[model samples]
Target: MAKISINLATGSLQQEEIIVGIDLGTTNSLVAYINPEKNPQVINDMGRGILVPSIVHFNEKGDALVGNEAKEFLTTDPENTIFSVKRLLGRSYNDVAAHQDTFSYKVIDDDKESLVKIKAGNRFYTPIELSAEILKELKSRAEHSLKTPVNRAVITVPAYFNDSQRQATRDAGKLAGLDVLRIVNEPTAASLAYGIGLDPSEHKTIAVYDLGGGTFDVSILAIQNGIFEVLATNGNTFLGGDDFDRAIVHYWIESNKLKEAELQANPGLMQQLRLKAEEAKIALTTQNIYNEKLGDIWCSITRITFQELIKVRVQETLDSCKQALKDAKLKTTAIDEVVLVGGSTRTPYVKQQVADFFGRQPHDQINPDEVVALGAAIQADILAGNRSDILLLDVTPLSLGIETMGGLMDVIIPRNAKIPTKAGRQYTTSIDGQVNMKISIFQGERDLVKENRKLAEFDLKGIPAMPAGFPKVDINFLLNADGILTVQAVELRSGVKQEIEITPAYGLTDDVVEKMLVDSITYAKSDVAQRMLIEAKSEGEQLVYTVERFISKNGQVLDEEETKITLVHIEALKAALQDGDKDLILKKADDLNEFTRPFAERLMDLAVSKAMKGKSVD
Candidate 1:
């Protein structure tokens, strides 16, 4: 007789390993795995439910609380509770400045171009760290429920996520102690869960419309011979179910004659109203009217009126669908199927609208919320060599990037990304009257390019002479199926272009690639710290230059005391930049920003008033 190990917690035969699938979502997250019965199933640990709210709260002890435990802090301690962190990942301060106020927590904007940071309590955190906490919770739940060690995973991201965002997701998973085997697109995963690509013989062109709590994206996918190729993707990162909640909140405020100032002053009431609005949005889905009240504030809406409020917003998503089709260069008639994903699709109007637009009924057999995770599980099984019929996509063995300001390795195509892919990012010159831009390509995982392997270098010649940050340089990397890389650089404004080809893995053996990967992980902490410091110094230098130039031109606009204070702050930042302390440099830069913001606004107002000096009003 042969003896087999058993998992006491699950009362099942223990496997040697398990590669779980994780949907690290905006509003909620969940983990799934292929069970012993060869079925993809979500883990519901201790009956706590499958969906974990993507929220993290920092307590007085400075410990992080995630998921359901952190949900309550959204009202009681909004400043310490972080939600919708996915929106901030791989985004600069300028990228999300307009929407920063929507987040209750403080988002640090040291420089407009650097990645956004969150300040919860006294400590500053990147979106990657916050997301890691959520991933850790999911990992713990999966391990507990499966009664096995789960160290590897397949994570999903939005279809429109760029290389930086994808890399950020992978780093977050690494921080959570999981070796991310692949980053699958959410729409692609959703299609897999619906069994659309289970059969290699199946050929179809489908559209996946995903509208989550904080994000919306429509992806056009063409499946042929078990390969899922994304033709195009379009959506607004900030437009989603949250906007629907906001619409209801605005209607209530207008209907009840509530003051915006009062709501701003009373956060608890605002949170209550927001939450109630969310409830009403859900209730109106099945009922004709949803009526409720919090204290003296009446929250009321009819299904008809609710739909009317969100009609424009819903139309916006439909327009995105149209744009996606246009980008894919396909007609509505070309679409063989439409898949509805995300919890927002539960709304009757959204489903019907998508169905009508596609000229066919959409697929929603799988739960919209769990579809992506289940699909990820299936993919994980394939990666684990359990499925042979489905083909596993080939991926790049290492990250591919270029050297940006401060010699930072700005990854444009991350490691483990599916091959035969292309991605690009915009860049700008750093000096005045710059005519030529250097493009240095590298392959490795280090934060700085000098430590990575340089693949090629070239210059984008004939750039029109212009001031710093004026030229729009787009660098694109296209990796073909045979492991050949083609890099193209173009000055978008002038159409001055340059292209080069290189073999990314030429002369590199498996051991060398493996060593590079190991070295990157070993130095991940120090590399990130060094990269952040360099970015801080670069930001400080840019700020100093901008402030000095402003002072030189607009000295007369400032009073003596104002000018004196501004100069002092500028000098402080310069001094901090001279030192190597990243935090101090950021602190001084922030001080300068705070001091100059009011006068900056005043100067703009004066200019506007002068321009309108005898003009008639609209």
Candidate 2:
């Protein structure tokens, strides 16, 4: 008989490859893998801990420090340290501007429909890049513990996350050098962790109540024949375990008659109190009382007092549960299990309230903090072709997006998008007097586009020479049942059009597609940086062409110094282009554009005046 080793976690055959699962959370994150004993375990190397704080610190030299090492900087150097960046992923400036004061870091308010950027010292970073730092930390931990090349993973995200947000998570994974095979929902992963859906013949309907550090959500899941389907999901992104900590602080402030402005003025003191409140919250989970103080500030609370402070917040979760049940159209009696997840579930009040609401004892057998990660490991194992009992659905393993301004990718069709599905969004130019737009299609899971598997590239030409953003370009990607993808772009205003048909996975064996996807992530960071440099070079070449043409035609219109400076700046840009540095190219491009902009505008004015010089009025 031939020997065959089975990974019980994923029900898949164990090969040389290892696919771990990652629980990338708002408050904390953890990595998990199936042990040799077949039980899934969270990695805790050198007792650093299972849960790594999702905090990042930027040193004076701008080197990023992540997780526990960076947590202390939240109070000391809040401006350069960022936490809860999950909230900012895929979010535009307008999406978070109202609460800008909440962040100690400088979240750039560009005041437009563009992705937000964080300015850490002199450098600007997008949320995708910052998130990569955290994932990189987790990846290092996994590699260190396993002593192997841990390149592939299955990461979980909030069920309510939109397509863009999900793409952003995949991108972060890629940037961190992980081939994210799948993006599982947090609730589904939690249910898997508790061993709810492993038995294909067993059927059950469960509600997963996930109350993490910064968010709370309830999901009603129906499990049938090894398939877990989410019937409905509901929650408030603004409510979670962090609110409990804040509740204690709010109660203390009210009872002590402390001024909100005073607390606002003293961020250091406020941060101290917040951490103390968090300690009190955790301590009250097992004990009835917790007491502490910082100088004159009294941070003391009993379990009963803590329950009162969180009463409303707990009720809010229950309400969301009711709504989820209603949306799922299932009665409480129909639920076979209630799974508790998230670090906040340790609170006694939460467990009791959830049990009462469901009329059954919620499952807390698994460690709530680690359940999602364990579930993810199981999913990863399944992806490795280990599991035979589970029925899997076919999906496009990666996201599809078009390269947009600044080398960023805008996902039109997200990863796991059902096959034969078509999705698209409109876009416009980024510069004034722009006449054409280049649409480059890519297949990958990263936000920073590594569109090396570019399906096709073509220009939508003949756009009216108007101000930036004047033209409406609608790019549509249609994938057929046979896996042929036709990417089409049309300028609605001017009817300028172009498109190309390509088989994204054309004639390639399943193994080939899988390898390409893995390689895309393994080199995602370097790929994106190289793509940026190429883009800069292309733009520099285009500028050179345009400037030379303009100077030749209008040499008689310019003064001697005007002509001299323009030629000099143009030469400098050409030199920078040859140096092959993206940043240098962009700087030279901007400088050249700034100097030439007024001249171009002046030319336009002159043409308009010449046309109307002798025309009658009115």
Candidate 3:
């Protein structure tokens, strides 16, 4: 008898493998799996406990440390110990600029279009890389606990995470030596932890209100026949238990008449107070009063005063719940279940307020911190074809794309997109009288096609000759239920067309595919660094080209000093690109853009005014 395989993400045939579930959190991370007993269990990593602090520290010799070992550096080595990195994922300088100072470590302030990076030791690390470090720790824990080579997983992220953030999470998993099959939403996973969608004939509408250490989001889901669909989600990524701790910190500071500068000057004192506040938060959950001091720093608060200080934050969450309900077109009474998730849900006041608002006690029999991971394990089981009660729609594992000019990867169907899906984007020629347009298809997360796996290529011939950026070319990707990909390109003006069918994994053995997956994780850091460098260099080169062209075309519009300053900054950016530092290149790029933005806007206004003169409304 021959054995058949299954592709966990797409439901296509492939080699079977054990799939783990991961919850890559801001303050802590963990891994879980459906064990031999057919129960989802969190990996303890030889009695180290479940919650692995989402922290990384560098030693005197620059050796990276993760989890509990890194936790000790929070106060001693605040500059090199990074925590709560999830808030920085897929974010730019402008995204978190207002609160950048809150971080104990340095966050690079550069181009708003570029993703944020942090400075730790001699190197710069993006949030994706920092997050991958945490995931790597979790992966090791799972492998040690299972005593097997754990290579595949289903990871959970916040429902409100945008495409970039979701992709970043997937990339982090890849970097952590795991083939991320699916990126399940945290709220959906929380619901699954309680077996809310076990019965195929059942129907329910529920709200998952998750307030974790660093983020909060409330999702309204409708479950019918084991299918969970999110109706609405709303919350603050910057709001959570961390804010509650800060409330205590600030209260103590005010009561003691301590200046903000004094607290800021003593890193050890701040970290101690923060830890004390955390202890106090947990203590008040079971006790009415928390009175303690950390190295002369008082951390004392009554349960009522603690509640009073964070009452506004809790109300903000309630307002978000109301907004989510309103958007879902459902009332509080219509919600059948209110699921509380995340470690912060242990707070009695938070629980009571939610109960009061919904007029029902929240469902939290399962541990809030582990709920998402447990749910993810259930999702993995479904993917493994272990659950006949639930049906899963087909999906694509990696994004499918084609190579564009400057070696950029232009995506057609992003990863995790439902199969039998068709999405197209219009393109245009970059040069005058351009004829043939080559379509090179590839798949993976990197921004450049060179870093991804190339499937095939074809050319759309007989395009009507036209000026640059004028020819309308429509490129479409149609993926079938079997995972076969068909790419088509057509010229709307001339009706010239070309198409190709690509079997994404054609002729690739299971070991080869597995090797590729492992290779992606092994070279993850260098690949991401290379990709960022390429992106910065590409943008800088393009800007330099545009500035040169603009000077050639409209040099008369600028003063000598303006022209000189612009040219000098352009040269500086060009030099920074060769410095081989992605952050520096991006910084210079931002500087140049800022210097020219006002003058460019002024020039545009003048041209528009000149064109609008004597023009009247029809």
Best by TM-score: 1
lDDT per residue as tens, model 3, 324-407: 999999999999999999999999999999999998999989999999999999998887878877777767766788897778
How many pairs collide in each candidate, listed in order?
0, 7, 0
Lowest-scoring 10 consecutive residues by lDDT in candidate 1? Answer: 6-15
User: Against the unseen true structure, what C-alpha lDDT does each candidate score?
Assistant: 0.87, 0.81, 0.83
Ordered list by TM-score, greatest first: 1, 3, 2
In model 3, state the lDDT of residue 481. 85
All candidates: TM-score: 0.83, 0.77, 0.80
The best candidate by lDDT is 1
In candidate 2, position 517 carries an lDDT of 58
Q: Kindly list the per-residue Cα lDDT of model 1 for residues 49-71, writing each as its tens digit.
A: 99999999998877999999999
Instruction: Report the candidate with higher lDDT, 2 versus 3.
Output: 3
Q: Show pairs that collide, candidate 2.
A: 11-386, 11-387, 12-386, 12-387, 13-386, 171-446, 171-447
Residue 407 of model 3 has an lDDT of 81
497-567: candidate 2 lDDT, tens digit per residue: 88889887645444544554555665687865665576567667767777787899877667899999999
After the best TM-score superposition of candidate 2, give how far the Cα of residue 549 lies from its true spot, in angstroms.
21
Off by over 4 Å in 3: 1-17, 58-63, 72-80, 104-106, 257-267, 293-298, 408-417, 421-440, 443-530, 546-618
